[model samples]
Structure formats: structure tokens, C-alpha cells
Target chain A: MNRLFVFCEGPDDIRFFEGVLKSELREGYASVELIAYAGMKHIRVDGFIRGIGAMGDDYLMVADIDSDRTVKAKKNRLKRWYRELDTDKVIIVIKEIEGWYLAGLNDHASRSLGLRPLPGTDRITKERFNRMIPDHYVSRIDLMIEIIKRYSIKVAREKNRSFRFFYWKCLE
Target chain B: MRIKQVSCRNFKSFSDLTVDLDEYNILIGTNAAGKTNFIRIFRFFRDIARHGLGNAISLQGGAEYIRNIRISSDVPTEIGIIFENELGVFSGVRDTRGGSHTLSFHQIEYRFSLQIEEGGYRILEDFLRISCSCTPDLGEGESGQGELRITHTEDGVFYELSTPEGIAIEITEIIPPYLQKNVPRSGTLLIENPLLVPMPGFQRFFAEIAIYDFDPRTPRKAIPLSGRSDLEEDGSNLAIVLKGILADPEKKRRLSNLMTELLPFVQDIDVRKFMDSSIYFTVTERYGDEHPLPSSVISDGTVNVINLICALYFDEKPFIVIEEPEKNVHPYLIARVVSMFGDAARNKQILITTHNPGVVRHADIEDILLISRDSAGYSIITKPARREEVRTFLKNEVGIEELYIQNLLGL
Candidate 1:
């Protein structure tokens, strides 16, 4: 049986992927492992890809489209570091992972978190997401934990175009 | 009683800083970030309690060296600590059954500052205050709430005791003749006459704050059988301490189980007295034909692990400060060592400094105190858990070791 290894840029991305998408990934692989590099730039992507390849396992690299206008531009930026990177296996989060977290909340879940239901979340930055957190939540981490618990994949796919593309192309 | 807070001014790398201490604290930072200097504060207090203030200052290379180099010599070096006893209120009176009741204080705040003089140092300021609430039923006159305050000024030292009714009385009239004759000018009255402080175990608590920076070679060497049961700062008397622990069947079994769990090769450990009136421990391996290996032939890591176990388990000190507990410890066994320290912390306060990622990975965010240097080279201490970014990273399961390695903790 083949193993699927999902690499994330940081713990927030890892938590979102593991909490909401691990089962979807398990459909095509016997086992799924989530690894966080803490930050994408800190990792030597080529070495990690080769190391995982040598283990006879498939990998998915997840990143945020920070400051990049398009997925093609983001891929181009990453290509400067490792030209041989399998851009086909790369999945870019629209704007940031905070956007994906916001995308998962439906009207009821949003109101429960003391937030208003958002039509779309492609432009949600970390600062904007933090501003949306209710006063009762002690910290951003606390709000993030609650968001993961109530995350709805179907709502996320409808609210985020990049998430919809990721679901269809990779998870589906 | 346990130390709840410590403040230092112009002391080593600390110009003016205060840090709150928990039951278990882990100090993490780059080399020369003042972790050692922070631990030195405890040692300074211990020295002052055991020896006089003058000797304690000299032990750290005199007042000039003890003070922050950036600050001028005219600025007095200051150190203060607050202790709290959470157990219960203590009664100082003796019961009718001929048994003496334990004397304890609810809170103690002591602060002192000294200036570097021409030939030697002189005490510029000395202060100590203790507050306690006694049960009315304990004794006839011991029922009311009272506070004792000792202050030193330009004129002379004054001892004042106040009652719950706000009535203050000069306690100097009742001072013992011996203490009056030996009024300290170069030292604190609290250290000079701890018996006069009205609290038992206060002096011992400060004097017995054990700070260990273990050297494996010292533990490997055989020490005289007459060595004290307490583990030395360098762990030179490991055998003597282990001998005391092994005498108790319960502690010995726990130690044996821990050794086997940490060092799988070991079957048992035993101490032996040599013909030269010295003693050392030997480790029994499960498979080796040379069943019991002497301490001399044991590995440095093994000796250090044993010494640490003895220190954490056997030492009766109220506070234990160890520098770099991961030193010579294998990565695999580092978790066990840290877990042992955590378990031991429940009974007494434990503080450790570490540069090892394994140690940080196993520690809770709240237990960690990050030390960094400011632009002026003064040490700054902050709890990473209190920082918003750190909490976000940690709540998302990012290993703190990663944050430390990447310098993402914001120093």
C-alpha cells in the first residue's frame, strides 16, 4: 500500500489539513502523514522531495499564495529555489491559511464564534482573521482551534475557489 | 516556603530586572544570555545565609565583579526575593503535650543593597518584612495578626513589630545581647541572626538552595565514606548520596527502575566502600560477563545520568537549580530526565537551563523562560507562552524547538 505524505508550511496549515482533509487523502493511500516545516522557506524542498521519493511514498506540498497574484507566479517563485520541484504536486492556499479557516465556517458556525457569515474569504489576511475573533476567545490560537472543530469542507469548497480547485484536483 | 519572585539591579548582566518563578522553570537562550548569571543570584543568597555577606560578595570575585560592568561602581548592587508558604499558617507556641509546634511564616520579603567602598563593600540598605496570621486557639497571646519589619537607615537599624490594631512597637529593646554586640555593617542582620527573624527553616531554606553544574569526573571519583548524604554542587559525593537513597527500599527500587528504563543495559546499581576508606557505585549489566562495572569504567553519560537522578530524587533542598541538565545525556533519555524533573518539582521548586532542543521539545510553553540581551547588554527574561505569536505557533502544534532554532520567538 502506498503512503501519502502531506507537507505544510506551518502548524496552522498542518492542523487544517489534518483536521479537515486527512480522511479525503486516506481514500487514495493506505496511510497519511502530515509534516510541518514551520516555515516553507526554511526547508530544502529538493532534499525533502528526494528523501520522500527514496522511501517509495507520494508527497503533496501545501503553501500559501502570499504576495503572489497567481498560482503560476507562486510556482515560478518557488522554482527559483529548486527548479526541479514537481509543481504538479504543489497546492497553493489562496491568500493565506486564515482565508481557508474563514471559508470553512457556515452562517451558524460563524455566529457561534461571534463573527458574521462571510460570502467569500479569499482576501482574509492573518490580521483580518484576528480582528474577527470574539472577545471571549483568549487568543488567536483559541479561535483557530474552535474554527478547526466546526470546519465544514463543503462550505469551504463553495466559499474558496482555490480550495474548490484543491478538492477536485487532489483530494477528490 | 518557596521563592515566588526575584529582583536584581546592577547584578552581573542584570541592570534592573525582575522575574516571577513557578514551581518548574526552564531557562532557554543562546550562550552568554545571562542564564548562568540568573542562577548565580540564588547562589549569592545561599552564600550570604551560610557565610556572611562580605564573604558571599568575595566568593563572586568581590562587589566590583558582582555588579554589572556597564554601571558605575557608585551604584549599589541590589537583590531581593519574595517567599510564600502555601501549606498553612504556622504557630510558634509549644503545646501542652511537650511537643513544639512548627514555626512558619505566610510571606517573607527581603531586599538588600550594598556599595563598593575604597577597601571593601558597605551595606547601603537592608530590609526584611514577614507577615503571618496565627490561630487564636493555638496560644493565649498568639491569636492576633502581626507583621515584623526590619529596616536599616543612615542612623541605625530598627526592628519594628506591628499588631492587627496598627500598634507598632520597637523590637530592638528585646534584642538578644549577642546580636546587639555583633550588629552587621558589612552584612544583613537577617543573615547575621536568622534566629531573630521569628521563622524557623528560613535560613536553611536560603542556605540549602542547591545549584548543580555537574562534572562527570567528580562523580566517578571515590569520595570518603564520611561524605555528606547531600549531593555536591559538582556531584562529587554521588556514592554517599546514593548510599543514603539505597538504604530506603522504596527510593532504591524507584532509582533501580529508572536506571533500567533510561539505560537498558543496566540490571542493578550498588555502592561499595573501598579499602582506602572511600566509596563508589558500580553498575551491573544484564549481558556482560563483567557483571558489575566499577564507576571508573562507566561512561560519562551514564555517570551524569545517575548523578542527576540522585540529585532530583534524594536531595532535600527546597529549591534546585541545575545548569544544562541535558549535558552528556543521550537524546533518547532526555525526555525521561525531563519527566523526572517535572515529577520532582511537585514537592519542591526546580529550575534548569538548557541549550538542547530535546529538552525544549519536552517542556510546556508556560514552564519556559526565554532570556535575551537588550541593546545595552542587559538580560531580559520573558515567558514565551505569554506572547501572542508564540501562543499561536504553539497552539498550532509547532514545536518550540523549531521556533528557537529559526529565531522566530522574537527574542
Candidate 2:
């Protein structure tokens, strides 16, 4: 089994991988470990990856695309930042990590909040927790945990193309 | 004197980083990039040469502290150096329990390595060869090359050139013989071993390497008079060192001229012994009628610059390791010290760890070792590469000072 050193942009990205990827690609990333970074700003896309490659372990860096107009644009910018990266893969989540949760909005746990699914696969910012989710029982992130527990990988892929792309890239 | 290159594995902050050094190697790194740890390699060897293997390891907070945390204990902490062997100039006195012995050599290249064993440390590898410059004109025996190798394995330390093929046994007088059976725990006692009599000069060069962390506080203070063999680690006996320099009129004149160029305001410097029998320095200002200021009242820049000039000017160590000479020196004075370090490298090797922008600006890109750490905090030293982007950066007039500030010297 390949050991995965997953560098996440924030806690939510960590949760998404722990809650979702922990089951999706069991054999590929049997020993997936997550390191939480402050944000994309705090992620050193190059040195962080360069140093780990020679360890003979698979490495992945996941950061949200917020400042750049598109994921491709963000990847381009990172390419310039890194110039040359060996044996490490960089995968950018579209809009933000929260957009990943929008993929699972059709689940029964999410529907219990009586909130509609986020349309056009746009990012569901943290503010969306307070605006929606009436009669919320726990914290915003706790609710997100529940949402992920009941998340439908099939519906998520149908709702978000970038999410589907990212998922397949990891499995590959 | 010259270190062609050095490689380290599981040594301090460097998990695996090989650095090629120039005559004047200047290293600049961000905080916690382990630049100090990089220089510690030489200090580690120097400590071993001064004390022994056991004391040096303990002084560094034990073997675990010296080894990188990322590396497993099962893997030995390996450190090695490969340098151009300037063997003829070595002057080392080897002391043994039996007696002291002197040896001379003309070595071509020396590869010395040490590994931290489970219990302590051992000299695991050594390879030395005689210079090919030896020709028939000198002697028929000198025409070809001679090899000396000492290796430690599960059995014992093997003197490859010896008859018994081990350091534990002695050899005939036809060849340089082995004198001891014990394994060297701290460092290779190559000079003392008859097996390596022809390569003692290489080991002496290693013994002569100096690493300094000059403290501006207490060591610089007046203490009871004690004989100073060389500059103390803490800059103690600085006044005595200054007094010794003053004893030589030409050296004193050169220092005064350098200071005059560096600090134009300084008219003259006086080293005096007081009623308390302690020595101190006083600087006279060039400006009119102002009373000479004692070292106690002088600026930090004056004291630090003077100490550095005196220390570097006289010390004959082929390799001198200094940390942050830019500390407290005036901006203009920092440049002067930088120039002095550069000029001194003509005769010897100098490795300086610096964060000062002026020092960075003064360094040639090839001479600058840009150090950065991985997320796991292992040091990665970057040298100027032949990549097109680097070429563009070099041609675009972007000084290393600015490039480092921008964090663009990617490692």
C-alpha cells in the first residue's frame, strides 16, 4: 500500500479527506496522513513538496482556489511558484474547499436542515451555515461532519465536475 | 584548507544535503532553516579534535540531538568530507599514551567519514592517497601513487595496506606500521597511526579548521589574566589578544589603518593594563578636543568590528567558520568587515552564516548558499543552478539580497 502524506489547506479540507476519502480509495491510500496548513497562503507549494519526494512515499498537496479565477489558473500560478516539482502531485479544489460539501448537499442529513442544495456548484462559504440550517443542533462544522457522514459520492460527482475530477485524480 | 565538498546524512537539520564550498562561502537563510546547524558540522569535528568522541557527543546534548529527528535511530548518523589534500603544509604533534610522535606527508585526497554507532560513535571509513605530483625527479618510489584505507566493519578497523590487513596488528618496518589496537571513538587519529604516516598532513588540516560564535557580552569583559593560546570561544582574553597585536608594530599599524578606513572617526586605539591588572582598549576620536573613549563607553559597532579584525587578521586557520559578523556593526562598517572577510579568503577558506542584507549584496551568487527548510524542517541548501530561469534572474540584475527577501531562491 502506498503511504499518502496529504497536506490540506485547512481543517475543512482535512475533514473532507478524513470523512470522504478515508473510504473512497481505501487500497490506494491505506495509510493516508493529513497535515493541516493555515490556508493556501501559508502553503509553500514548492519546498514543502520537494523535500518529501525522496522519502519514497507518495505526497499530495491540496489547496483551495480562491484568489485565482479558476482551478486551471491557480495550477498555472503554482507551476510558476514551484517551477520544477518531482514525484509530488498538486490538486487544487475549485472555488474553495467548502464547494466540496456542496457536492453532498442532496443527502438526507443535509436535507433535514430544509436548506436547498447550493446551485451551479458554487462554493458554500462558512457564512452559509448561519444563513441556512434553521434549528441547527450543533456547531457549523459538526453539521458539516453529519452532512459528510450521509454524503452521496454519486450525487456529489454529478453536481460538481471539479469534484469528480479531483476524486478521480487521487484514485488514479 | 579547501573543502571541495561535504556530504551529510542524518546530521542535525540536514537529512541529506551536500554543499560545495568556495574559498569565501557565504550562507544566507531565513530563520530556523538550520544554517547554524550546517556550520555545526565543522564545529562538531573541531570539538572531536579538541576533546574526544564521547565528550563532543555529550556536549551536543547526546547523539539524538545531533541526529536529525526525521531519521530513525537504526540508521547511523553519517558525516563525511572530501577535499583537495594540501598535505605538505601540515604541522601536527600526535600524542599517544606511549609517547608523542611527529610525521610528515604529501597526500593527494582524503575521504574521512564518521558514523554514530548504537553505543557512541566510531570512525567507520577513511581513504587517503599520495599525491601523483611525486615524480622520478624526486624519487623512483614517488613516481607512482600509494593508497591508504582504514575501514571499520563488523570485525574490526582494517588497515588495508598493512600485512595483517587490520589496525589491531602491527606491520613490518618496510611499511608504516599500526601502533594501537583501539578503535577511535571521536575521530580518526590518522596522524598518530603509523598506517597513515604518509597522510598525516591531511588530518592536520582537519584539526586546524576553526568555528566561532563570538559572544559580545561576558567573554568580551575583563577577566583575570590567563594565557590565551588563541581566541577563546566566548571572546575572553580579547584585551590580551589586542595587547599582543599591539606588541607587533606592523600588525598594529595595519589594524589602525584598517580601522581608519573602516571607522574614519577613530583616530587611534590604545591597549592599556590597569591598576586592577586587567587589560582594556580606548579609542581616540579624530574630531577636535574630544576625550578618548574607553572600550566600556565605546559603541558596540566599534568593539565588535575591532574584535573581528584582530581575530581574522592573525588567525592562520585555513578554514574559519564565523556566524553573523554583521551583528551591531555600523552599516558602513559592516561593508568594511565584509570586504576584509573577502580579502582574507585569498589565503584561507572562510564560511560565514549571515542574515545581513549588506553581506548578501556583497556575495557572488555562486558563493552564496541559500538555505531553506522543508515543511518537516530539514535544511535544503540551494546553489546557483544553470537553469534558464536562474540565468534570467542572474542577468536581470536582481541582487541576491532582494532575491532572498522575495524568497525566490528556490531550494
Q: State TM-scores per candidate.
A: 0.67, 0.61
lDDT per residue as tens, model 1, B265-320:
78888999999799999988888776799899989898888888777766778899
Q: Evaluated with TM-score, which candidate comes out highest?
A: 1
Q: What CA RMSD would candidate 1 show?
A: 12.8
Candidate 2's C-alpha runs over 4 A off are A1-172, B89-132, B138-144, B152-157, B161-175, B178-203, B288-290, B385-387
Candidate 2 lDDT tens digits, B1-411: 477777788888888878778888888888888887888887776666666555767878786687876677666676666666445532222222222222223334444455566656665555454432322222222223334455544454555432111112122321333433544434544433334343444455666787776777654465555567477655656777777777887567567655654666888887776776677777889883667776777777677777677657667677888888778876544544665776567567888889888777655566788888877778988775534666577566555566677777773
CA RMSD per model (angstroms):
12.8, 25.8
lDDT of all predictions: 0.78, 0.63
Model 1 per-residue lDDT tens digits across residues A36-146: 543333345677778878988898888889898899999888766555478898898888899999999999999988888999998888778867777654335446656
Please report how far candidate 1 places residue B69 from its true position, in Å. 2.2
Q: What fraction of the true interface contacts does model 1 reproduce?
A: 0.00
